[model samples]
Target chain A: MTKALWRRPEGMSVVFILLSGLILVFIFAPLLKTVTSSGPGTLWGTLLEQDVYTSILLTIYAAFIATLVGLFLGVPLAYILARRSFWGKGFLEGLIDIPIVIPHSAAGIALLFVFGQQFLFGRIFHGLGVDFVNTVAGVVIAMMFVSLPFLIDSAKDGFRGVDVRLEKVARTLGASAWQSFLRVSLPLAWRNIFSGSVMMWARGMSEFGAVLILAYHVPFMGHYPVADSILVADRFASFGLDSARPVTVLVILISLITFITLRTIACRGVRT
Target chain B: MIKIRALKVNLGDFWLEDINLDIEEGEYFIILGPTGAGKTVLLEALAGLYPISQGEIWSDGREISHLYPEKRGMGIVYQDQALFPHLSVKDNIAFGLKFMSYPREKVRERVDDMVGLLKISHLVERNPSTLSGGERQKVALARALATDPRVLLLDEPLSALDPETKEGLQGELRELHHRVKVTVIHVTHDFEEAVALGNRVAVLNEGQIVQVGTPDEVLRRPKSEFVAHFALSRNILSGRAGDGEDGYTMVDVGGIEIRAITELRDEVHLSLRPEDILISRQPLHSSARNSLSGVVADIIPRGAVIYVTVSLPLELTCLITRQSLEDLELRRGMKVWVTFKAGAVHVF
Candidate 1:
């Protein structure tokens, strides 16, 4: 009977009801468990630890880098996607969206293969004294790869939402193509770009698998920047992870703040 | 001077097959066709907006088909007043001059002159959206004329406005054309608009110029049935010319004799304006030779004029004032005498 009520002719189905219900479950179930523990100390102590602080800081730093990277590479490409039509446009769009569809661990493995020892980029970079294995560069690359699609897709949709007629009129009025974009299309799509920034930052913060695979040895820390490049394969994992533990904790803490900001921006983007 | 010869362009489904026309300096010519007859495409082609498939267009004795719109030295105003929404009225007027590499002093001078001539100086700083329909029309005119175009192409600029506004705006545009003495090629489907604004009218049907002449020539003697209908012409009588005195022609129009002043070589076709016919109850004996007895069959009240159709053996259309219908006690099926001069009887 409830299903029937929700399912009117050409109506929203019971799946929406179940989806909202599941969200309510995920949000409340955790708080309910914490409440039953009879202590807020566990949560508070976990929050104040040095490793936690360091991880949170590293997350913010790396996410900030990822967001900035997304901006530089994503914006012009997005404008191209929105504005012009050329051969292989659909194929190019699908290529941009590949990172989003692939599993995160698979994405990590893929990055590792490309930037690892004995690979093209890996050998070239190693020749320049740049090591990708167990480093912060890998973390940022992973974050950027996973989060770039969001920024590009959002920015492209933003530019597409603007009317082409307005631009044409501007062109007739003696404004060049670049001038028209800056004056007409850019201001209109700014809100979408802003939302894309938040999404990019949040996506960067949550990127774990790719970071773990490629550059996990920057000693993810709050103040002390550790650069351990020991060449033993087993010692490699044990030493670098110890240094990155505090940084990981800091990442988790900072991610909470960014997640809230991203949620607010995304909700507003959808609403308006 | 503006000249277009055998302009052939295949713009998708609405191809302009062969359009040929010319306008003398300071002449007002209107190209008229129904909607989707490629009127806009023709105008844009002249303005260098579209590539000409096969044609030669000359403006001021220079061929400009290959030039860009900005380099073509022509200005255009569309039906939907495409004022740059971002700019003020002053800036909009200054737009054309800014391009074409005008100096700052000349741009300002030209803008001022045009704004004053169009009498839109008060609206200079205001946005286009804030202006009324008539005001925007004036601004569009000002902007188009600012750079002093060799040929001004107005594409149904009055189509979207209300009747009163359209009439007033066209009057203003007509006055502007005269004052500026610019070669204007205006396009509209409105017959009266063509007549009111055109010194020479070209009636286009399906992208072909069926007739091009003075309004009187086109109206008095239409080249074809389409041109006749397009002008809302009321005179069409199918009859066979019979043997008469050498110069004086006699034709039988549905058993009624019509005496025409001109000689007829073949079957007689009479083309007369409805306004030329004078209706009466009694047949008057005068120099006017053609007088036919008929009954008023239909009375259609158009705006400020009445289309009174008299059912003689041949249908005769007469234009009379609304007051005449009541004053003459005219009604459907009322017997009436339709008298018109032989000179007014057109032969083609």
Candidate 2:
């Protein structure tokens, strides 16, 4: 059976098999090397470090905050874009795609112009004792600015996949607009929205350029730490590949565990 | 009662213009049209799902042209049934009741009532995705009816089912309407379904209503050549009026003489429904004044009905029940008498 499965007549093309094998090896080799380069003891020791643990915690919580804010603002915009046609709709969709094309550094600079201390909205927030400069708000906003398109676009696709007739049926069934959305459209689009949220959260957690520019130093869980992306970069720059390899492997393992768990839940959600 | 006047709607390339309709209370009104005739658009406009460019809609002595759909007290069911996939059958049936603020126990009781009403008690715990197409349709109907809306809008609700399932659901729908007595506006392209369910029907073509009347009237007297071909699927023939005797006019159709009850001009078009003509081995003796001897050219069985083509110099298609065809022992090249009342001929 194994011999017949590998035979040419089993329908695998030689060229496709060769090219796919090459690409898979190219992608997996680096990940495998990184994981094995550092001993399991060294990775465990790094995870036990208070500063390293706090940095990872800060990155996750900041990304989580950013994702929650993204849901409040992005999901409605996605629903509107999916359901209605109005003037400038084409231009608005183009604007949503603009963030993905621009450099992350440029995006950070643009956010700084609107959110820096001297700006009007920034000063108003400053008066309320909520500062963005080197604060958690700064990290969240910077991450949200860079990662929101994933949430909005994915949610829009999810909403578009739902039949408009379903919403109309809800409306005629004595459900108000908000009720219909909460009861019908939201549940049907939930799996895609959830997957998109996970992507946005993961992307925000690994954000480097924006967080480095906006908030590089902060007291996270009583330890002065930056985002994990910045810490990894700084360690790589200062100590070279040999010293930074363990932290990189640790981060990859943590991301993989979370991604797998959440993705499994999302896939299961769509079926049941 | 529901009335629409001068209703005009524009949805990109498709548009409905100068539409007017009056539906009696508790009547099962069918909007019959082929695809892209704007039947769904008109129904949606009436349901307040789509905004109309121009028109006033009045229901029950109140003008509700701009009222929101939820406030209008109407329910709509799509062809695919559009049941909430995430919800169980019981929860789906209870969805609209949540908006109505019914107590939890009352909601459950009402859901049970609807479940029983639709004969879907066994499916309460099942997911909509797990149900069969007919079961999904029943669940959708139950959900729509749970709120007890003043009017129900059905857009080809049975079009997606198999033949046997569709027939079963059609009977169920008729029974449901008879028991509930809610005003319904059903949209469909199937003329047989329209005839079976509609108390009155409006024939729509190319974004306009061609005619509106009782099913008997619309099927018996189609106003235009389009309706003659589309709505009734009648056999039409062009002929000239030659002479008259008593209350009938003799029409010369392709060298064959036929009598008609309507007053005739020099040139006229005639429509005769296939089912109105009866076939017999010998000449039919009765009040039918138009009997012609013709040879059976073909016999085509369509489900329970058969379309028999008889060539009486001018070939005409006549419909007969398969049982009658078998009883008459109809066969190709057999000589038969085709008889129809002169009044059955519609002049256009």
Scored by DockQ, the top model is: 2
Residue B36 C-alpha lDDT in model 1: 81
Candidate 2 residue runs with Cα over 4 Å from true position: A1-18, A44-51, A87-91, A118-131, A219-224, A269-272, B280-287, B293-295, B321-337
Give the docking tier of candidate 1.
incorrect
Which pairs of residues collide in candidate 2? none
Candidate that would win on lDDT: 2
Candidate 2 per-residue lDDT over residues A1-272, each given as its tens digit:
36545644435677788889999999999999888888889998988887688888888899999999999999999999999989999999989878777888788788777788899878888889888878889899989988999999999999998988888988998888998899889988988899899989988988988888888888667777888888789889998987678888988888878988888887783554
In candidate 1, position B174 carries an lDDT of 84
Model 1 chain A: which ten-residue window has the lowest total lDDT?
A: A225-234
Error of 1 at A10 (Å): 19
Model 2, position B220, has a per-residue lDDT of 82
Cα lDDT of model 1 overall?
A: 0.77
